[model samples]
Target: MTHGNTSWQEFGQTFVDQSRELNQKVTDEILERTERALVSAKEKIKQTEEVNEILKLRVEKAEQEARDVKALLSRPMREIAEISGDFQKAYEQQQQILANWILSQKAYRETAVQLGIAVGKTAEEVQDLVTQNANAVLENRTEHGNDSNTNPLVKEYASTILAIRKKNGEV
Candidate 1:
């Protein structure tokens, strides 16, 4: 009976030791798996952060491009609006110049028609002189402008007409 009791005690001790080893092995496997899961989760988080940063930069670039496009569209409109006012001013100035030109032409024609029979000039001669003088003024003021090479004959003819008009009190 004493030997049987001793053998049962040894058996019970072996069982407890095996159970403790199994529990420890299970705990170690659980800890290892948990550590692996934690490492994988951390890697996923880092990748997600990298992707998020890239997306943020892309979004910022797209927003800046949109702003630039909007500014480009409005810039032309602003320039056109500014040019429109300039065109209007130029048109008004041109109209005034044309009006002045018409008045001067009318006055010139009236003077030519009324110029002098008492100065020993026939109407035909007076008309020819007026036409030549007009041609000279136009030549000086046209494509070549005032400082260009003027025709000597036309200049002399214009000078003669001016002298005649001044002398006859028809200036």
Candidate 2:
């Protein structure tokens, strides 16, 4: 009876030791898997943060470039506007000059007709004078090519012609 009880005790001890060993192995495997998962999660978070930072820098650079482009465009736009204004002013002045020239020619013709002293000779002389005057004006305009401002005398003549035209309903 004593021998049988001793054998049973030894058998129970071996079984308990085996069970404890198996439990320790399972706990070690779980701990290892949890550690791997934690490492992988940490790496993913790091990559995401790096990508976000890169995107932020790119956006900032783009915004700066947009501002630079806008600044560059503004100068040319303002210059174009100024050039357009100058063109308009030049056109108006040219029109005024044409009107005055026409009026002056009409007045001269009327005066010659009233005097009645050889109209043919007077007309030829007046034509020569007008041609010479036109050439002189062209030469002067070319010489002072940079002058964009209207001449006061020219403006006065233009205004007188405009008034005359208005009175005659010829405008």
Candidate 3:
């Protein structure tokens, strides 16, 4: 009876040890699965944040474009007729200025020829003198301002020619 009792006690201890070992294995598996799930959740969160940043940038760009379009639409537009009228006015003014210049040049040429005749200068000499005077006027006007139609040299020449003609009794 003592031997049988000892055998029964050994069997009970073995059964308890095996149960504890099985519990430890199950606990290890549960811990490993929990760690893997946590890692996956963290990765998903990071991806969601990156996508949100991209969406925010896109929204800002779209809003700016909308504002630019609105501003363009709000400005007043010019009519075709108004623009055409403005162009016509400018053209007419330019034409009038050109006509005045042509008339002045013609008068200057005739007066210069008369002066050449009065002073016994050849036509070619008179033309050269006129060209030199014109060149000087152009240079001075370009350097300073083009506010005057005549220069001092031209005035002096006209006065001298008038005096010469008057003295010769040809005026």
- What tens-digit string does per-residue lDDT give for candidate 3 at 44-145? 999999999999999999999899767654654333224457656766776788899999989989999889979999888898776655444443443445
* Top of the candidates by TM-score: 1
Ranking by TM-score: 1, 3, 2
RMSD of 3: 16.4
Model 1 lDDT per residue over 18-107, tens place:
999999999999999999999999999999999999999999999999997677556654454455676567666767888998999889
- For every candidate in turn, the CA RMSD to the true structure comes to 16.3, 15.7, 16.4
Per-candidate local distance difference test? 0.72, 0.67, 0.71
Q: What's model 3's TM-score?
A: 0.39
* Residue 45, candidate 1: alpha-carbon lDDT: 100
Alpha-carbon lDDT of model 3: 0.71
The residue pairs found clashing in candidate 2 are none
Q: Score candidate 1 by lDDT.
A: 0.72
